[model samples]
Target: MEPDIWGIVWLSLKVSAVAVGVCLPLAFALAWVLARGRFAGLVLLDAVVHLPLVLPPVVTGWLLLLAFGPQGPAGRWLEATLGVTFMFRWTGAALAAAVMALPLMVRAMRLSIEAVDLRLEAAAMTLGASRWRVFCTLTLPLALPGVVAGAVLGFARSLGEFGATITFVSNIPGETQTLPLAIYSALQVPGGEAVVTRLAVVSVLLSLAALVVSEVMARRMGRATHVL
Candidate 1:
C-alpha cells in the first residue's frame, strides 16, 4: 500500500477505536435502561436513541455540525472551558463516527441484556447481593457475548462512516481523512481507480475480520456463560 493509503488506514483505525471506546459506556447504559426499565416515554427514548439509524447520514452530520461546530453552543462551551474543538478535526470525525455507530451498539446490547434470564439476577439479588453486584456477577457476565458483538458492530460501522464524517469534519488528509474519506478522495482524481479498488478491498477485509472476530468471541463467551 502507498504511504498515503497506510496513513488513511491508520487514521481510520484510530478514529474507530476512539469512537467505540467513547461510545461503549454510554451505549451499555442506554441498552440496560431500554432492556430492563419500564417507565413512561420508554418508546420515545428508544426512538430518540435510534434516530441516527433512521436519519440520513448527511442529516446526522449536519446536526452534529450544528451542535458541535466551533461556534455552536456546546462546541463553544467546550472550547472555552476545555480548549477542545471538534470542527475540521480528527476528534470531530470520531464523534461523527460514534454517533453513526451508536444505534447498532445499543441494539445489540439491548437484545443481549433482554435475553439474560431474570431468574439468575433475582436469585443473586435474593442472596443479598446488591443490584450492582448482581449485575456484575450475573447479568453482565451473561451479556458479555452480546456486548462484544455490539462493540464489533460499532467498530465496523465507524470504519465505514463517510457521509457524516465528511460532512462534519471534511476530508483533510493526515488529519480527518479516514478510510472511507480516502476512498472518496481517490475517486475524484483522474486515473485513481486503482487506489479506490485497493482501499475498497482493504475496507471489506477489515469489516469481515471484525465480524469474524466478533462471532468467535461471542461463541466463546456463550460457552463460558453456560459453564458458569
Candidate 2:
C-alpha cells in the first residue's frame, strides 16, 4: 500500500481511539444517570442522548457544524477560553466520532449498571461504606465488562463514522480523512476501486476486531462478577 494509505489507516485508528477515550467517562456518567437517577426531564435527557441515533448522519454532522464551527457559540467559547479548536482539524474528527458513538456507549453501559444488584449496594452502605466508595469499589468493578464493551463499541463506531466526520472536518488528507472518508474519496475517482477495496477491508477488520475484543472482555468480566 502507499504511504498515504498507511497514513489514512493510522489517522483512522488515532481518531477512533481518542473518540472512545473522550466518550468513556461521559458515557458512564450519562448511563449511570439514566439508569439510576430520579428527576424531572429524565425522558428529555434520554431522548437527547439518543437523538443522534435516530437523526440522519448528515443532519447530525450539520448540527455539529453549527455548534462547533468557528463562529458558533460553543466553538467561539472553547477557542477563547481553552485555546482549543475543532473546525477542520483532527480533533474535530474525534469530536464528531465521539458524538456519534455516545448513544451506543451509553446504552451498553446503562444496561450493565442497571443489572447491578441493588441489594449489594445497599448491603455495602449498611456496612458503613460511603456511596462514593461503593460506586468506586463495587459498582464500577461489577460494571467493568459493560464499560469495556461500551468503549469497544464506541471505538468501532468511531472507526466507521463517515457522514458526520466528513461534514464536520471536511475530509482533508492526513488531517481528518479517516478510513470511511478515504474510501469515499476513492470511490469518486476513476480506477480507484483498488484503493477502495483495500480501505474497505481495513475498515471491516478493525471493526470486527473491536467487536471480538468486546465480547471476550464482557465474558471475562461476567465471570469475575460471578466470582465476586
- The per-prediction CA RMSD against the true structure, in angstroms, equals 2.9, 2.7
Q: How many angstroms is residue 223 displaced in model 2 relative to the true structure, after the best TM-score fit?
A: 3.6
TM-score per candidate: 0.95, 0.95
Q: What is the per-residue lDDT of model 2 for residues 1-228, given as tens digits with 9 covering 90 to 100?
A: 343888899999999999999889999999999999999999999999999899998999999989989998999999999999998899999999999999999998998899999999999999999999999999999888878878888888899999898888898999999999988889888889999888889888887888777677767655522211
Q: lDDT score of model 2?
A: 0.89
Clashing residue pairs found in predicted model 2: none
Q: Model 2: C-alpha RMSD to truth?
A: 2.7
lDDT for position 204 in model 2: 84
Q: Report how far off residue 89 is in candidate 1 (Å).
A: 0.6
Q: How far off is residue 127 in model 1, in Å?
A: 1.4
lDDT of each candidate versus the true structure = 0.90, 0.89
Candidate 1: where is the Cα deviation over 4 Å?
A: 1-3, 223-228
lDDT string for model 1 (33-122, tens) is: 999999999999999999999999999999999989877899999999999999989999999999999999999889889999998888
